[model samples]
Target: MSDTYAGAPAKPGTVSARISPVGGLDVLSRNEVARLRGASGSGLHALLRRCALAVLTSGNISDDPRAILEQYPDFDIQVLQQDRGMKIELSNAPAQAFVDGQIIRGINELLVAVVRDIVYVSTQLEQVGFDLDASAALTQSVFEILRNARILKPQVDPNLVVCWGGHSISRQEYDYTKLVGYQLGLRGLDICTGCGPGAMKGPMKGATISHAKQRRRHNRYIGITEPGIIAAESPNPIVNHLVIMPDIEKRLEAFVRLGHGIIVFPGGVGTAEEILYLLGILLHPDNAGTPFPLIFTGPRQSAAYFEQIDRFLRLSLGDEVARHYQIIVDDPETVARTMIKGLEKVRHNRLDTKDAFFFNWALQIPLEFQLPFRPTHEAMRALQIHHERPRHELAADLRRAFSGIVAGNVKEEGVQAIEQHGPFVIDGDADIMRALDKLLQAFVEQHRMKLPGGTAYEPCYRVLNA
Candidate 1:
């Protein structure tokens, strides 16, 4: 969240610009703008611009942060107040966001989401007056933010399936994910994801067609992202609802809490982080009986990827961890049918336990999994990745290890950190470190670390096998 103004070019399109407010957001106070301007320099402002720009340019393919910034270098967004409502003032903004001099409706909606989330997180989430420390309070705050964003439908059924996977993936694997999504949609399930390309986009694209066929009027394609990763993988065109959490931890938590079940497609470090996070929660003894469906799936070509992931999980988290998820390959219909059966079981469990169907109220997420990880070099080096610890705690550390790699690979702060400090060093138990290193190397070989067109991704972290 650092602001880089020195030597950075100003918005290219113009010295000044004006735009009207539409849809959900329409107001901002002078006090808010002054605070925004004041806080913009302290690092948050640069983050705002990067995320705002990503939202404005929805289908941006380039994964490089500098390239995206350079493309819309002249774009600057300002908050303006009015008697009737509030309007955003864009100075030399991206011409793509405008159609015949008027903002495109979808882009405007996403822009409002950017402003709404940024302001809420900055003012409410970070405020000393708010009780952000208590775990229940933090969870409640997530609920409030989603409610304010109008994402949580109180009357909706337990059918929102959160799909977790990599942004960069193989073409056939992506098509398989789409087929699975189509089957799920035919069965009346909604889709949610990290909301980028590859596996994330596949399901939504597939479901859109089935949803149309089934006349499912309220098909939800929800996208949950954070500022750190949004620039690299901008919201895919299929995203109808986008909510940016304050960080990746909260975003992952939102997925588990809001979704009825989870589907894991082939992914790299980020996907591994997500898997470990979920398994850690479900592995907790208290949550042993909870019925939350988790599926690890891919096309036939992706079988090796899941096999490696499975072996790593069995070796590190214990074979007991296998109780948590099922792997289905080359069968989209079976994947959906398996998920549907799991959802039915989940519904019964919710009814029996008196928990809400829309959110997993009974899942116990420890503070270890809930807290934000800064993933500094020292932190990466200090992680205890081993077999002796409780499985859940090990999962937490493993999740953090992947989280650090994720930062190094994409996040702006991470890139800057890597630039300043060379490469991050990840040290761990010899066996676990070897497996982790091997999996990551495979990701690099398969081009899963970054988008296809960028310069070859240089290794950002070193593995130290102890």
Candidate 2:
């Protein structure tokens, strides 16, 4: 509990405890039980270990998620289904998560989240009936995952705000996000984010104070993440409702569909990728008339940051794309007011359109956006970033370019590829590639690419002029 600026690194701990799986997760199929039991290659144990460790080390500082694994290479998680409930046994878990003997309650809940989502996705939802390849069906699958996690609320009146931003952001930018979150919470809105540090965690932290002051009960600090990038950016301790989506695409889709409104804070490649994903869908001819409220906000110090982002969007997707979002800086109250007003419109629009308030059933997310992009060397080179295609289609490619950059920066497979092969080669229209290169460089120069004080940000992909 000492808020010392620096302290000796806490040595790791080992614990044995029995925790009942929350929300009937204990009733998992025997096959699901066996998969969690696997600690080796054939079973889903490796995925379970990485995710469990990430939760146990919630406030992790290093962006190279592999760092912890390498440090505690023998760390293992086991699921024991007894006659009573479920017990999660952890060996070589991080010591920071425990005070005396028992694990922190919040960390325990998050650990359960790791097992819950991993089991659900691996066992039930990925079956042939899920039809993951079908665009509309895939969107439904996102709803199913969220619903199964009990995230989609039936009686809510549009108060969930999904906050998007980079894990590595400036101190000033991070503070600005708190102000925005405070304002939103004061107005009775819940906050959701990618569940990492920096911009993603700041709002939730800010909102907690406001919600406490307002005596708001049942305030949800929802954190939605996928395992691939999660180790690099562990969940911020504030996240109470954590759901791990199967992959990045489904993760993004879950955010858009589950929340009533979205606010983009100043960020790096990951943030840019999210912006492009929404822009692409918003610009789609079928979705042009939807009433989703989107805003880009930051503190006054972040004006230059926004300017850089705005320039990139206009340059890459054309000036008309500006119509999809508004940039409000330095004012949390206005950001809150704007979101409230916008969500009112969202509610009315949903009622009039007969769309479910829990999920945006009407949003037309095409197959290209739904399917996961591997960001392999060949795939990065194959992206179609140009001016001639429809703006939405162009946004998808731009999204892929950013996605590849994000992968190269943090995801496990992406990092290993960069180590084995050199940086990924991204070929695109001359002007677009130049702009992309410049923006990525700024991220590194500002130390927005990786957690501060870690190794210098390494370029993960090379941009080629078309």
| Per-model lDDT | 0.83, 0.85
**Model 2 clash tally?**
0
Predicted candidate 1 versus true structure: per-residue lDDT over 1-466, tens digit per residue: 1122233343544223465655587467665665555544545566678888887778877777677887766767766677867767766567676665667777777777888888877776677355666678778777767877789887666889999999888889889889999999999999999888888899999999999999889678999999889998889888888899988888989999999999999998899999999999999998988888999999899999999999999888889999899999899999999999999998888888888876676878888887889989888888988788988999999999999989998888898999999899987788888888888899999998887874778999999873
Residues 1-466, candidate 2, lDDT per residue (tens digit)?
A: 1111122333445443444444345466667778777732345888888998888889887888689898777666778776766677666567687777667878878888888889888777865477777998888778878887878888789899999998888888889899899999999999999999999899999999999999999989999999898899899999988999989999999988888889999788899899999999999999977888999998888888889889988998889989989989888899999999999999999999988888988888989999989999889888888789888999999899889989988888998888998998987789988988888888888888887884667799888873
Clashes of each: 2, 0
Clashing pairs in 1: 11-74, 12-74
TM-score of 2: 0.95
Instruction: Tell me the lDDT of candidate 2.
Output: 0.85
TM-score of each: 0.94, 0.95
Best by TM-score: 2
Off by over 4 Å in 2: 1-12, 16-18, 22-24, 39-42
